[model samples]
Target chain A: MKLEMRDQPGQLVAALQPISAVGGNIIAVIHQRETPAATETLDVQIVLELPEGRLSRLLELLREQGVSVVRIDEERLLYECTLIMIGHLMHTDLSDTVDRIDMTGSAEVTELSLVMPAISSPSSARITIRSTTREEMKKAIRILRSVAEQKDLLIIEPLEGA
Target chain B: MRIAILGFGSVGRGIARAILAKNLDITVTGLADSRSGIIDPAGIDLEAALSRKDNGGPCGSLDVTPADVVAKADYDVLVEVTPTNVDDGEPALGHIRGALRRGKHVVTSNKGPIALAYPELRDLAATNGVFLRYEATVCGAIPLIHAMKEGLAGNTISRLYGVFNGTCNYILTRMAEDGLTYEQALAEARELGYAEADPTYDVEGIDAGIKLVILANTVLDMRTTLDDVERTGITLLTPEALRLAEDQDCTIRLIGEIVPEAGVLRVSPRIIAKSHPLVVEGTLNAVTVETDLAGDLTFIGKGAGSVETASAVIGDLLYIRDRHVQGS
Candidate 1:
């Protein structure tokens, strides 16, 4: 995982805490002091092996400690999220909805099914999204919600830990 | 690492032997030819397979095709070495597409598939999150693609020129040295086993054109096809042309040149100074890539052979292995 943190004292130590707390094993840490390209903060790249489902908790812990994650390798993400969008999907451009998810390299909508009650009525789509981690899936769901909000529609996201 | 060999020709056999001789942790889980296929999750016995095929056995069965092995085999990669069909890159292109779509990395020597459908295939591989490597597709054993793409990754390539087709190079060399006409040079090439019985593809510049298209797309980040290359075969040049070049301290080589700034891509019999990097003699392939950071880089080696091309296949296999290991 790549992270950006304020170049403050103990920030690196603070970042390491959540990883170990979530049953993660650190493999390497590339903490170069110089600012990376087009970024104001310090770049800390961590290679780690964590258990199957603790990545979300790790991200939460890091967020609580005020460490900003810049990127995560696709291998580290291992979670699935299936979302259902309700209302005027075709009118609002379903392509945009799917494109928003597919464009994100971290997540992909692998399966999608649509149901339309009538020609005039709105459609409901069941979109199955797979990501490398739970946080990435949530980020996609957030994008879906924003798209739904802009189009004056309703989004029924997957249940917690489903 | 599990590997599936989609073609059982010389290249396929060479890679199988290299894997065994090198004692890599790779296993041939699936093997197939144009007519049939066989699969074993544990591994296919290379020696037995070779002997069986050598004895005129089908190797597997006519019912199970190469596509079936690619789809059903317990393998991480698909090594595509089938005969090239420049007309449309069928069978080979379909095999590569199926493998990439199934989240399997592809390593191929069949130039037609790459030459014709590179952009689509490249996007498919990226979307499916797998690699598509074709080092043996151009300049068989010279490592030109890897050298330009990875070794000189930092530099911006400006132009490229080279003798890409060994058969054509051999014919041209004979024409220049022995002062033979086109027919005589071609006959010599066939006698020396440098060319196929029907050498139209090599002698007519289509083979070099395909290789040039592959290079243009892969390394130069240009999207061009076999049709886009302004091609002129070496058959048109005469011994007088060769002698004229020699008098000017130059030699005529079947050269493929690409000047990206001018948007120029062509393959023809061009006269270059004898001192030029592309002026290699005999059945050797050479490519000179002009780069901003690394200056002029020239790569020369045997462009085609059973084992030499197999060396490139091994390199690609290990490349996929290392990337897989690192990613996983």
Candidate 2:
């Protein structure tokens, strides 16, 4: 999030205080003090992580702090989970399995590593999925689980932080 | 305290050996195997009975049956360490009911009765003013049930999960370590006596599921059964699948989990980090209890073995002895 605030003594602190107040974790703060001296406005770029549905509240809080929003760059899919699937992957239309999660729009299969040992033996694949939120991640896993069930595949999910 | 023991098998013999090794002040008044039983108002000769059974014979006279020991024995506690019959929990269930009805404390390693019929048995114990304990039913020697029921009594347990089955753990450990296929690892486990000839119960997640049901019903105060568990076993696990987990510095383990609040009971092969406390080696078992007050507590110990399981049973017996029994 980029903000334009008064070029005053406590303006940057005021702008950053609202980020924490809204439960946003500030990753980086680029204060551009070298902006042209013609305008009495300071431009600060903040890279932050906010819990879902807090962006609008954060923007309102920033506005209340007399900070005008310049631009907001949103990285939606921040949550990821990796799982292992074992079965006849190629024969079971693996693309469709990946497509189900991708079609959700809130989640997508980000990476996959597959191993086919023999022509007749079961194949194995490691799938990494990214979702916009933890709830979406769970929904993504449920979709994958159902697809795996239909395919008669074994899905080995992570024990924690899945 | 004088006690009667039913099913003189590995666990029974282990209890007998522990009793002989230590002067724990426990008196075995009655003992029975499938075909025979011995009853003595005075303590039974455990050493002689052990030797007799070691020679491929019954533990005692065929004239006395296990039912006779349950009904007629003069004892304060009943150690029901019979083989688990998951179907209906069989004679072990009847024996447990008999002991509780006779106003006796009951400790068992049998998963069947506890998993299938804990509520009725618990009420029976309460009505009879006796204690019913089955610490050995899950995770062998971890003292998990005691810890949950006594140590962390007041705290709320939000989640409980870990590697509950040793046979599956052994197979997964072998598969991950040596890059062995499921078949090869299971064969090695069977040869090592970690798994039975028919490995379906252990490998199909039924054993872990049953343990989950037992914990859910007994400790977590959840009404759950084996069918309620969403189960996935290690049978279809491949060396390639293990390799994928290993490549990321993780390994696969059969984890049994119960979330009381969410009403979740599941036993499945999970990909856990190698550095996880629950990622125990060989046949070791580990459980992590997520409690509200004390945070998370992880317990690691031998999941199976005659002596290890007997440790749980003896703990339960001594618990009853210290509190309820009249004299040591």
lDDT of 2 by residue, A63-89 (tens): 898999999986757888999999999
- The TM-score of predicted model 1 comes to 0.65
Per-residue alpha-carbon lDDT of candidate 1 for residues A1-162, written as tens digits (9 for 90 to 100): 998887778889999999999999899999887555556567899999897778999999999988888998866445776555557889889888889988998888888777665788656566678886777787888888788779966554321232
DockQ of each candidate relative to the true complex: 0.01, 0.83
Which candidate comes out best when scored by TM-score?
Answer: 2
Predicted candidate 2 versus true structure: per-residue lDDT over B189-212, tens digit per residue: 999999999999999999999999
For each candidate, give the interface RMSD after superposing the true interface residues on Cα.
31.5, 0.4
Q: Identify the leading candidate in terms of DockQ.
A: 2
Enumerate the chain B TM-scores of all models.
0.95, 0.99
Query: What's the lDDT for all of these models?
Result: 0.83, 0.93
Docking quality band of candidate 1, CAPRI definitions: incorrect
Interface C-alpha RMSD, model 2:
0.4
TM-score for chain B in model 1: 0.95
